[model samples]
Target: MSECCCGEKDIYLPELATITRMQHMNETELFLHLELDSGKELGHMPGQFVEVSVAGIGEAPISNTSSPTKSGFDLVVRKIGRVTNAIHAMKEGDKLGIRGPLGHGYPLEDMKGKDLVFICGGIGLVPQRSLINYVLDKPEDFGKVAILFGAASFEQRLYQDQLARWAQNDKVQLLETIDKPHPEWSGNVGVVTTIMNQIDIDLANAISLICGPPIMYKFVIMSLEQANVSNENIFVNLERRMKCGVGKCGHCQINHHYACQSGPVFRYSDLSDIPEAI
Candidate 1:
């Protein structure tokens, strides 16, 4: 019953998603906790994203940072453009237009009982955190767990609070690095690939999930290859500009496949020929 950023309303229109709480992680980044007007729990899988619209402004895709097991979800919005900036200006109780929990999520069911290695970089952790939390909730279902994460600088780190907690847990291995190290820091410095060199993985039973900027892929994949991890065992999430969350929009297409539908999450072997994809 609230106004949307977009004036248009119909089946293509979005339902109301009210901001319940807000956390300002940094200047440009904010995490919004949203509850639906339908009063039904927002059910979505890890790696899926929602199209958020500000009334009379526009809509942009934002990935879910919270676990699917929860009643509500959290969105980490980066205020880099118009629509996002409009969303950033909104406050708690503001109703934003939400289109979907679109895109195919990671196939976590297939990963059960396998040693899971998560390689995340910067804001890539947004979606990756979902899988991480799912695994943490049912740690006994999987084998050894390791998370190798990196950020540009100390201030650029995402989910610092969770990272700190992860670093302390004994059941899993957590290694983090920043490109530019500060004097107060003593942790690993350099790229996340450096963590690959130190961890001992069972190549036969372990699988690695990679998510990050395009530049991080080649190097990370190369590192995984060096470690004898098979291409089939490696999965990746590819990002594309999506206008429509469904396959009807050509914006997210990569050759024959649609990143919004067929992927966003894919086995590396499935993308062996997609050059643009990393």
Candidate 2:
């Protein structure tokens, strides 16, 4: 295989990566830690995803759940299809093929010194965690940080220990809720949007990042607009639309824009002309 000038192989070819750890976060989700066999870091920024493959099972695009500042990369895979099912069956010492740190990432440089409000629902938190950790790791580079997460129920929550830690950290403010009430849960009991009322940021100087089910976008954007947060200051992660990490497949197209190429992350204002996007 011919190597690119960056010393990596062709983007279409999968490089071998070894799984270093695996943890079951819930009944359907598996958290994995991997390192490239080439002994080099994945060198991914927050919000980029990688294409993972098993020998006969096919490939799927999975987001990097960890920040680039960390030693190894992480992914939280939901057992929904053949590729992910095969991934869940893997063990700690197992190996898989990785193709990228693909797609455009969040605009971290522009976000410096601006307050951030992260809103996530269900498994959408997987990709958002990357940027969350990146900002937390360098608190002085940013302003206030707030995270609001909603799950179907308390039992469906991912990264319980980390959530607990973020809750305890004075530098971060976290609010978690569920769609419906559970006997063991005494915290907020409502959809993710319900907690927006509790946010206390300076809307004029704040930026909001949202990632969740397709259905949640409209209402969340409405809530943000009602609160007077500018569309230019709002961003969304559409990583779920990615099929082929490279733009050739056309699966992630929204009108003339290729989400995988131009963005898995986009400023809300830029998508105004693309009705199908959101």
Best candidate (score: lDDT): 2
Minimum summed lDDT over a 10-residue window in model 2 is located at: 2-11
Clashing pairs in 1: 4-55, 5-54, 5-55, 5-56
Model 1 ranges off by over 4 Å = 1-11
What is the per-residue lDDT of model 2 for residues 149-204, given as tens digits with 9 covering 90 to 100? Answer: 99998889888998988888777889899998998999999999999888878765
| lDDT score for candidate 2 against the true structure | 0.90
Cα deviation at 188, candidate 2, in Å, is 1.2
Clashes of 2: 0
User: For each candidate, what TM-score against the reference?
Assistant: 0.93, 0.95
Candidate 1 TM-score over all chains jointly:
0.93
Residue 153 in model 1: lDDT = 85
Off by over 4 Å in 2: 1-9
Best by TM-score: 2
